[model samples]
Target: MKKFDVDSKEVPIDILSDYILKNPEKIYGIHHNKMEELVGSVFKEHYNCEVHHVGMSGDGGKDLILIESDKSIVVQVKRRQSRSKTETASCVRDLIGATLLNGSRDCIFVSTADHFSKQSIKHKEDALAMEIIDSFELFDIDKFMGVLNLHTSEREKLWKELIEIK
Candidate 1:
């Protein structure tokens, strides 16, 4: 198994890959639910902050909402691949725009694919009236798990052998 530390707390792999990947039946004999579950698990480990998952189903373009103490962070998970760089940048811009419309200045975008852009980073600062979110970025399943004080090890190979259906 993979191991690490998040905000002095140790988050297991269960809260990372199994939940974020939305595939638990093939994992630890359970089901995975809530986009916030993945987000919460990460922020909790990284910052030791209180968090919740609003989810994306019927909630428009947002996936999760994370709260760190008094400040609230509006989060969007782009866990799918984009056909091209333009599409990727558009998705990030759209997420930021929607969060701004909702009056949240702190916007975070998480994706399974590489969606990092220079334009997003350039807009990290704003006037006193607005909150500028350059980006709260995360990429790759392994890195996500790392954020949660978790890891995927050689044990994953064994898991695949045992869990793969015939």
Candidate 2:
């Protein structure tokens, strides 16, 4: 494995992809709770927000809650890598329910799928303050590729922690 230093840098997507492909199943097949933590970490790092993992046994409604300026952004992470249109719709509906239950207006559904069906997208758009982050946008990969800079050492530590998390 390569080590990263403390200078702000962008780790190439190809390199990260290659690393993921090395043990695709293990990395991708992590449990839902672990996935929530990974997603929360990504958001926390990218948005400079306080993220709390609330998705264990009795997670009120959301998997994580992102606190930013007196606003609580409820997040639900679905590990379903693929789902039909109806299933996607169902997931959105669930997110809506979670939002209402948690009394949070801002909500986000993060998934490891490329995209949701058109109907699902429309449904989410129609809902109140709902945002979907599909697989491609799941980790702000593009932002990471474009401008987001992280100390190489921090990035390395994050990568190591992600992969090593059971």
Candidate 3:
């Protein structure tokens, strides 16, 4: 077992996993609120930013709004409900639209999908956000643990845990 941070404080992944597994209904409660809490928690914890969730009714293509210092970042969290490239590209298009609407050049598209299509990736590079991070890189403990400087045997544990929650 290895620790990961939740609020700038390190906590073990296995302990977190056990909590979710034992109280599966708690996962249901989180999903009802969408991943806004998860994304906001991570960003706020790691980046020291204030995050606001714009609800579904009129989100303007952005789900979470992050503000740090003078910089404001618009984030669109793609839930990976569909596995189609067209759908993924469409989400990219929405992020571009969000940039246009928000008048912010700094935008990000985060998704649970394994990866975006080349078209979506290019579109992200060209029109919309400057960054795209999917489940593989974001949740892979081995990869991200390097960023966090933590070593762990549960490489894909976060992904599996989040998917189970979802």
Candidate with better TM-score, 1 vs 3 = 3
lDDT of 2 by residue, 1-166 (tens): 7653212134343343334345343333455665676567667876679998888776755899889888888887765543321236776777777777776777777765546666667666666333332211222222322222343346778889999996
> Against the true structure, whose lDDT is highest?
2
Candidate 2 error regions (>4 Å): 1-27, 57-61, 81-87, 128-166
Clashes of each: 1, 0, 0
Q: Write the per-residue lDDT of candidate 1 for residues 1-166, one digit (tens) a residue.
A: 7654322124553544544345422222222233345555566656567666666456666766667777666777654333123225566667777677666766676654434565554443331125355344534334554554343333456688888864
Per-residue error (Å), model 2, residue 29? 1.0
- Scored by lDDT, model 1 comes in at 0.52
> What overall lDDT, based on C-alpha atoms, would model 3 receive against the true structure?
0.53
Compared to the true structure, candidate 1 yields what TM-score? 0.55
Indicate the TM-score of model 2: 0.61
Clashing residue pairs for model 1: 36-53
Could you say which candidate leads in TM-score? 2
Report lDDT per candidate: 0.52, 0.58, 0.53
Candidate 3: residue 133 Cα off by (Å):
16
